[model samples]
Target: MLRFFRWYCKPDLIEDIEGDLLANFHRTLRQEGPAKAKRKLAIQIILLFRPGIIRIFNLSGFQDHFKLIQHFVISWRRIKSNLTFSLINIGGLGVGMAIAMLIGLWVWDELSFNKSFTNYTELAQLYQNRTFDGQTGTYKIVPQPMSRD
Candidate 1:
């Protein structure tokens, strides 16, 4: 009986209402028999089921909320219906992102390599054109003592 009352009563009113109900139930039980007391308690509890007595199911902005939920359901259905294609595309994206990160790191290291050097601005690269066998290639690597001056 107490559990039924607590379940129906609002949170803020539960304690006060429950205590009053129990007190009245005990008083009526002493005055009358168990049958009449139980009937009175049931009637009182039913009367407490009014608007402000119980929690309201207030669906504030229900239409907007439903539309957002519908959008999510549509997106989920699209992904679920094309599971194989989605997995393939996601895998490709992951691989491409990893390769891009590696290239970025390599470039960043090359650019910052000379930052610690005090004469970094004075440093220059040496390039040379050489033919070996049949192919001539431009190389950044040259033999030592290439600058004899």
Candidate 2:
């Protein structure tokens, strides 16, 4: 299998190489022992760089390889579908981040509003209820009231 992989530069040759390697490794293990088989397989893998060694398989062009073709087709399909989905995902994430940032800024601003005031310790909010269209609404007003100690 290693020989086949070293021979075929095409992507699809991976599966054939893997299968071949497994079959040869198992055969070697059965014929010899585990240690010898491992050593032999390792030697074969190492020797794969030798010229004219893997050329005996004579595999065709990369595009002719079924695995490469299948991968290309699948990738093309995903690219088409992912274009719109990816845009939506990015837009949603951007909007969500912006909203979160704005809320954080608002909270920070509100908290810091009275911090620099000279009468910060005496600051208080007064709550008043008003009726409009038969509905009651409550609002808080600054500089309104404080509790006596």
Best by TM-score: 1
Q: Please give, for residues 1-149, the per-residue lDDT of candidate 2 as tens digits.
A: 45545554344555665677678889999999899888878776766545443344545675479778899899778868899886787899999999999999999987776777777776654688989999999988565245553
Stretches of candidate 1 off by over 4 Å are: 56-72, 79-88, 97-149
Candidate 2 local Cα displacement, residue 16, angstroms: 55
What's model 2's overall lDDT? Answer: 0.72
Steric overlap count per candidate: 0, 0
Write the residue-wise lDDT of candidate 1 on 2-110 in tens digits.
Answer: 7877776778899888889989999999999899999999999988888888876567789889999999999889989999998999899999999999999999987
Local error of candidate 1 at 18, Å? 2.0
lDDT of candidate 1 vs native? 0.85
* RMSD in order of candidates: 7.6, 14.4
Which 10-residue span in candidate 1 carries the lowest summed lDDT?
140-149
Q: What's each prediction's TM-score?
A: 0.47, 0.38
